[model samples]
Target chain A: MSKNIIIASTSTLHGGDYLEYLLPELSVHFEHCKTILFIPFARPGGVSHDEYTVKVSSALAKINIEVKGIHEYENFSKAIKNAEGIFTGGGNTFLLVNQLYENNIMTILAEAIKDGIPYLGTSAGSNICGLTMQTTNDMPIIYPPSFETLGLIPFNLNPHYLDSDTQSKHMGETRETRINEFHSFNNIPVVGLREGSWLVVKGDTITLKGHLTARLFRQNQTPAEIESETDLSFLK
Target chain B: MSKNIIIASTSTLHGGDYLEYLLPELSVHFEHCKTILFIPFARPGGVSHDEYTVKVSSALAKINIEVKGIHEYENFSKAIKNAEGIFTGGGNTFLLVNQLYENNIMTILAEAIKDGIPYLGTSAGSNICGLTMQTTNDMPIIYPPSFETLGLIPFNLNPHYLDSDTQSKHMGETRETRINEFHSFNNIPVVGLREGSWLVVKGDTITLKGHLTARLFRQNQTPAEIESETDLSFLK
Candidate 1:
């Protein structure tokens, strides 16, 4: 079956709008596609259902894309196999991983990807694309025996990268140190995606989308900046 | 190297105070033990260094147990090998797993636990005592490339069991359902520890501490109540 997929970080339904980051490509991808299957159940933690899914579906409706939420589907395998385009909205990665692992949907998703589903991942949803879910700053507030991921993108993705606010009262590892920690163990490039930004992956090619720049972290080299046209050899 | 251990559900610093729930036998276990080590860094998310570690020492000092906070020891090997008795504080399970996996400390800790060091885990720290980090309410907020743990105590540990408060205001998965999901994949019994509670593991014996009750979620059966004197066969 033909498949194109888009997985978002946390949908703006709660905090901010990721629609602008998601919709343009999602709409363009769905433009020629016959049907779009919207996965609202990807909001795994259950907190995300009322917060984001409703907002995303309404926004996509305005853009003329017929988006269908996946939670209403009776058969999960059919929902996954029948979709011409699959868009996974993000909420909580643990919850997402838990549901996928429980329902045995991760294997199906990986198969669809290998079969060239034209997948797109953003934020938490984007996180599952990497070799492992090892770089996100989300709290392991929930646990799923394994940190298994889709392993499609073959890179560690850091979404919503923010500078340490010296004025803030939050006390935890800073973003820079956390990324450094990722580098301490992983040789793969860690992509820091700012708000409204994304990594667009086509056949054997990956390019940046939106107006935000990305910070690349690797071992033994100073972190470098990647402009829009930068070669994403890591993803390729 | 005499070893002392404190396996608590919540530390005195995390505003949960496990000492009040301390079994009288535990106090005797550490009576002759000088050089008490406080492991506050195990909890990577919620509790801060200042908030969790310093208080552990100060509280232990009140009872004449010479305490030392191990937060400054960045080296995992030295931290585990030379430690007198290691106490793991609670925060988030994902954060602890990532650090243990990234630094390769699980094997070191497993060895330490085997040497009869009094190992204590509370909430997030306690969750790390399982075979896998399967039963937790923390988000997969931080992903370590893998999900291996200390394997100190057999059976999964679920800290802080709570009922769903109508889900209209709460944002995360309910504790019961999350544990239920965990049982669907794992056949292991899950020990639900409330605040001010703990499980003291000595050799093959598992003793329940704290005034509150605990729920045990087993495979294919309804969760059963674990009374004060009930011996947990999973600890065997």
Candidate 2:
């Protein structure tokens, strides 16, 4: 079966309601599903899993879809296998990956997604769709057993990607600089997704979504700007 | 033996020459030493160790302190043991910690500093002085064997820390939010050091240096603004 997924840069856009920017797309993507298995491990603002799930539940309810927290299930593996749809919300990537490993659901979740349950991943959730979480901007509050992820896509992602402000006095490494440094140690490609951008994947086809142009960084090559609607399946 | 250390937030300030802002203090810090050993593993911008060493050499030359790259020595253990002073330049924290562990020098480096070896750590370098590199802002370009660092100080340092830009519309987690999430999983105190600020450790006393105030985050406590010259030794 062909996989269907919406890997978004963020759940909520600036000054927007939760999942506001992507509600149109999500409604269509999850049209046939009546429920979503919400993985709330990446708890934004460090909210509890139940609290995070409630936030997601309220948002998806706009499309008449019910949301259930994965933590509510007695057997996480069985939950992933039986879910009609899946939506993993954004939070800290390190904590998310750590919890996934702790629950031993990293691999199982990947299998279920590949088996083609409609999936939606925002921020930290989208980060795990990559080969590794090495390019994440989240603070390393907790260490996961491994840097490995689902490999749902060929490249890694730097979400909420920002261009360097030449006018700023801050000395922190810019998003571009951080990705360049990653190239120094590893050869994986990285997609720098701006706030409203996302990747829509269908089986072997992947295309950039939203209006913003994404920055693509490949090992030993200059970063290029990718326009919206550009097919990125070749990266695999 | 008493430890003498300078753990700074950055190596260079905006539009300033490298190490220019700290030269006056560094001169006094290394007054008794003529040659200093440099650890260039955190290769900022992916510069080679030799290249990074040259930059440090140029900066310290103003202080009459000759710099030698640690990579030059065949016996890293012996070289660190006999060094007059040690200076670890800033770059990628993950890379720095990985290299430290790869060389089996993480513990030795800590012992040397505790034994009264004057040490200077800027940015990624300063991060290692904490209990772990968990509070760093750098990308996880490589996986280190452990997040453990020198534990030279009682708490962690979040280098190049910036306050939330209330005017900006970007949705990335502010420095404060990231630190707050860290508090949820970890109990270690984190000092958010602005670009110009630093911490001065003399024996068991750790004081905030520079004119800027720092933000301190402790578990279950409200984040507080710390004034310059505030003695933070009690955090130990």
Q: Output the number of the DockQ-best candidate.
A: 2
State residue B168's C-alpha deviation in candidate 2, in Å.
0.7
Query: For candidate 2, lDDT tens digit of each residue in B1-236?
Result: 79999999999999899999999999999999999999999999999999999999999999899999999999999999999999999999999999999999999999999999999999999999999999999998998999999999999999999989999999999989999999898999999999999999999999999999999999999999999999999894
Q: What is candidate 1's lDDT per residue for B101-128, written digit by digit as tens?
A: 7767778887887788777666677778
Cα lDDT of model 2 by residue, A4-55, tens digit: 9999998888889999888888889999988889999998878999999888
Task: Name the runs in model 2 displaced over 4 angstroms.
Answer: none
Expressed as tens digits, the lDDT of each residue in A13-63 for candidate 1 is 234454664666677776765556665544543344555556666777756
Per-prediction DockQ: 0.10, 0.90
**Which 10-residue window of candidate 1 chain B scores lowest in summed lDDT?**
B165-174
lDDT of each: 0.63, 0.94
Cα misplacement distance, residue B229 of candidate 1 (Å): 28
